[model samples]
Target: MSKTSTPGQIRRLTKAHKMSFAAVATIGAAALAATLVPAGTADAGTTVAAAPVAWTQAVEGVQAKTVQHLSMQSKLATDAAKLEAAVKAKAAAAAAKAKADAEAAAKAKKDREAKAAASRSTVRKPVYANNLDGWIKESLAIMKAHKIPGTYNGLYKNIMRESSGNPRAINNWDINAQNGVPSKGLLQVIKPTFLAYHVPGTPLDQYHPVANIVAAANYAADRYGSIDNVNSAY
Candidate 1:
């Protein structure tokens, strides 16, 4: 004979299966919660996922302004570098010009000095011995009467060498010639030298020959080393 299935037995078995299914669903829910939430935090006070904040036209405009500002700063920096390079180039050119000018001036000064030195070395002093022979003889006689040192021959040699015995000898052409300041007589006597060295009661005319020769000899003996070297070519 076939056995009949009972509803109470079947209902008991279904209830046990339902409990096992509920236990499995609870475990899966716990694993998913752990993956979503931070450790040590209760789900009752947990943060919910928020939606991203929307951007406005004003915000986008700020970003565009920042990009423009960076571009402007880059251009300004490049301009500053160019300006500095130009300034450096200008300074270098100015320095080079100054150096060249200084060198040119120095060369010109040196050349002028050299030319002057050469001129001084080659020029000769004036000589006038040929015309004053008679005047010299008379002057020598007067020097003897006064008892001045040295023979007539020695005096003649000295005077000839000194001024070439020229009565009107003048070394300075520029002043004496222009002003007509006569260096009169065989001794080349200026007015001052004549007054200072004049023989007493002698005529002030330096051309008197006798007076001038004595005065010249006195001046030469006093100022120069001697009549000997005065006659020699310097």
Candidate 2:
């Protein structure tokens, strides 16, 4: 039998057909877009644009790290250079101080040696005198050094008898004078006799009281054992 559709049923059937058609149209539009564009071409534009930014950020991070490392290396090099310079400066100062100390020590040693040499030189010199008694004492000291035995009493007695204590006495009329060699001085020693018995440290001039006494005493000690042995004029 043929049946007629009610109005509510006809409306519901038309709504279902319309909804199906819209869904099919949307699927066909998506299919057509996929056919027109390449497989990954649609997202490639976005990826290409974002890739540069990401690469730039990564490079910038690497550059920052490299720059930081370079800065640290530069600081370390500077610190190392400063330390080396400080060590060199300290070594130089120590060397300079050692050199100065060595020089000072050498100077001190030289000064001490010079002073010691001066002292040694001073110790060897004999005392000087300029009088009869001073000459006698000086002669006595020299005689003591030479081990020649004589006393002041013997010397005075002999000098008084020989020339009456005259330091410049001359015997021009004696046998020695006739031979042109006059006995002279306190002990009346001839030039030959005085020169023969001249003692070291005594004056060369026989007229000198000390020179006369020392020569006479030397002669008497050599010929008669000692000046002290001659109690009278010798």
The whole-model lDDT of each prediction reads: 0.68, 0.83
Alpha-carbon RMSD, each predicted model = 16.9, 9.9
Which residue pairs show backbone clashes in model 1? 167-185, 167-186
- Looking at model 2, the pairs that clash are none
TM, every model: 0.34, 0.62
Candidate 2 residue lDDT tens string, 26-124: 999766655655565666435322234467799999999999999999999999999999999999999999999999999999999999999988857
Taking the tens digit of each residue's C-alpha lDDT, what string does model 1 give over 85-188?
Answer: 99999999999999999999999999999999988888563443444565556555555566544446656775665467665666556355457665666556
Any runs in candidate 2 off by more than 4 Å, and if so which? Answer: 1-54, 57-61, 95-128
Report the Cα lDDT for candidate 1: 0.68
Error of 2 at 99 (Å): 7.5
Candidate 2 lDDT score relative to the true structure: 0.83
- The lDDT leader among the candidates is 2
Query: Candidate 1, after superposition: displacement of residue 139 in Å?
Result: 2.2
